[model samples]
Target: MLQEVAGIRIPDTQLAKDAADILREHGDNLLWNHSNRVFLFGAVNVRKTKQHYDLELLYVSALFHDLGLTKKFNSPDLRFEVDGANAARSFLQQYQIPDESIRLVWDAIALHTTPGVAEHKEPEVALLFSGVGLDVMGDGFEQFPADYREEIIKAFPRNNFKRDIIPAFYEGFKHKPETTFGNMKEDIVKHFRPNYKNKNFCDCILHSPWTE
Candidate 1:
């Protein structure tokens, strides 16, 4: 009973279903819906450009990309992105998926939050990054058809996303502020935890062991 939205077929393989079920169990309604939308949006991009891609990998990557933000998957020391990426790597390993495919999923999840870089990687990585950007920030929003956008939203309502997603980001990694260094996520930490201090690149350079 796989459904198509905007002419993109949802992957129905066992691997896809298993990944979806795991995410559904661990993630809240907002996250679950958002993840599903990411997969569809990524697939739609590939279809729109008539580019060849591995749909199942895209689906799995999208499903697992934000998983590190969940309580069950959050780790104490690693970046949330790496946490999610490692989770995908371990899951794919169990199925004996090829190392190269696992690597793509890992990179896609790890770099999805990074601008200017993910877009230059393999198609799956780039598409996942764009898909997330489109859903969260409306990047490339105009390229999608109006009716298709309406349909996608209907299937996965984004109720109060603008107001709620910030809190979601804060709660996900507030406990691991150190991991936010070198990324925009530090802004989230700074906003909510006012007393929190972010690492400064210039400060590190000036205070290094070398004295001029």
Candidate 2:
């Protein structure tokens, strides 16, 4: 938890406090949170060390990067970086945050997702992206054959990102258990009944683990 000093100016004190509470509630000494906590400190510490001019705006932006995930929006896809950016913009406007800081907050929030792009522009954005990914990607990660990626993309909503979102990352870490037969729900199971060859299922059971 980085505190605002005499020179630090955090407009919404409650946003700062709520962010702290979210971290404590969800954190469990995980390296992701620990490093994030350090990143927060380092970003702010830059002011003291090098007299960085954007420390306050940077810190405030970092603090609310994930604010969209709050209870305000429950849809799975709505918790993403772009959604979070929109939420930040609205929150700042509601709180009457200065126009000068609005751009800083929006930039950080938008860049938080596309780490590849932020690599050169906003290095700190990449840091925060990793911080959030290290945790979010763990919960819903998954993987499938190359051919299945497009199928997954078609199966989910545009923003849902079945093939690239947090779900895909976590799923990639582990194979599905053998007990669950069929391609997901009952639809795919019945769709391929005409073939009756069962090549897909056989290949899945044979090539996939847990076949013993």
Extract clashing residue pairs from model 1. Answer: none
Q: Give lDDT tens digits, candidate 1, residues 1-212.
A: 34777677888888888998989899888887788788888888876667778999999999999899998889988899999999999999999899999999999999999999999999999999989999999998999777878888888789988888888988889888999998878888888888898778999999999978
Best candidate (score: lDDT): 1
Q: Candidate 1 at 46: error in angstroms?
A: 1.9
Give the worst 10-residue stretch by lDDT in candidate 2.
171-180
Question: How high is each candidate's TM-score?
Answer: 0.95, 0.42
User: After superposing candidate 2, which stretches have Cα over 4 Å from the reference?
Assistant: 1-15, 18-53, 74-79, 122-212
Q: List, residue by residue over 93-182, the lDDT tens digit for candidate 2.
A: 766778766766677666665545653454445445543443334311232123332332233223433333333222221222221233
TM-score of 2: 0.42
lDDT of 2 at 132: 43
lDDT of each: 0.88, 0.43
